[model samples]
Target: MKNTKTPDLPLSIRAIIVAFRVFFHLGWTKISKKLGTDPTTVQKFFQCMQRLANGSEDFWYLLSHIEPSGCHHPAPLIAPGSEESLEVRKAVLKHKTWMRNNAVNYERSKANLPPLKCTTVQNICLDFKHAAANPKYPKRIKRKRQPCKTALDEEDRSNWLQYTQDLEEAEAESDILTNELANKLKDQIQKLKDTVSQQQKNAESPGTLEWELLQQKNMEICAYNDAHFTPA
Candidate 1:
């Protein structure tokens, strides 16, 4: 008989390996486009892949057995502290309260109750002070005001006004140049039109051979139009 048993791998390591293979095959661009994730995340996936490849078999075995069904529910809140740290303290207090209440109920059923010594009231002021002293917290931003302007500043204002006036004069000069060119072009066009009209009149003069030829061409065009464009 041939030995054909496959070695067992951890679910977590196997998941990471699978994830790496999928990411590697997809590449950065395709992964980013398809998943709407950054390339850095894709790069991190490759790093994870490398670690799995070099790591121990136990890691792979542990990963393969892992399942989402074992997830724990979050504890309920019971602490009554400041609004910011209320949730954290509440969770701790709720756990304490649950234990104490359960113990008292159990003892009452047995006709032997134990006095509770647990206290949930915490001094969160010290925690707040420590947090405030931490450098990670953002400092209050201060707004700076603009310095007051004096009478001597009027000279600077006048200089800016003069600069704007010079800019406007330059723009006006450009507009005048454009208008002059347009007028010149219009005059030239009109002159050309007049010259063409004079030439047409000269060609159409009575007794000219060109005039007779034009009449013959017109007659041919009329005949062609009559033949091709007749009413149905």
Candidate 2:
């Protein structure tokens, strides 16, 4: 964590707690108004504090850096010297343990409860924060988020995979056909080019007018013989 100099009093702790609130999506304006300070000043302090937390430490401690670690529902407020509080504390810890490992909605659903509002959770966090500042406050803990299960089932994934494979196979077949067509056309073009070249060479040969006419007739007869013997 970066070396940060918070005020050497409860105001500094208040500021740190406010920064934590800000990390939980609370606006700086609301916190500042409640604390009777300039909104921007509170925001500046929070940003500085976040920068100082170098992010290579405890998960809850890392919340000082504003890194997303899921919704941290504040630790339950435990009053001092209460005998009946033991069971309440156990229940609270059990619920908090779920919140720490899973998303709010997921945990709520697992407990067969309706989804809780984020604002409600934030208010609870503030209450806990106040309780934490108490002389006999116990553990300071919060919720952590877990990755949600994918919506697509096995059938959908398999269908998508097959669809992708089919497209690849079609593309590969098209490429092969395209190459074959190009090669076939290239051979035909080369044959036509050779025929043209032979005609050009024949044109330059010396001969009498009558002999040249007879030569042309003979060449035409040979061409006809060759073409007539070829397959349809």
Clash list (residue pairs), candidate 2: 1-54, 2-52, 72-143, 100-144
Best lDDT among the predictions, by candidate number: 2
lDDT tens per residue, model 2, 1-232: 5323322224444545544464566676776656655566556555554455652434355444442222234654434324323323333345553453234456456668655455444333335543344334454334443445668789999999999999999999999999999999999999999987876676666664555876889999999989898867
Candidate 1 lDDT at 205 equals 98
Candidate 1 lDDT, 39-108, residue by residue in tens: 5554554455455455433545435433433222343433323342343233333344344334333444
lDDT of each: 0.50, 0.55
List, in order, the clash count of every candidate structure.
15, 4
The residue ranges of model 2 lying beyond 4 angstroms of the native Cα positions read: 1-151, 206-232
Kindly report which residue stretches of model 1 are placed more than 4 angstroms away from their true locations once superposed. 1-162, 206-213, 225-232
TM-scores for every predicted model: 0.27, 0.27
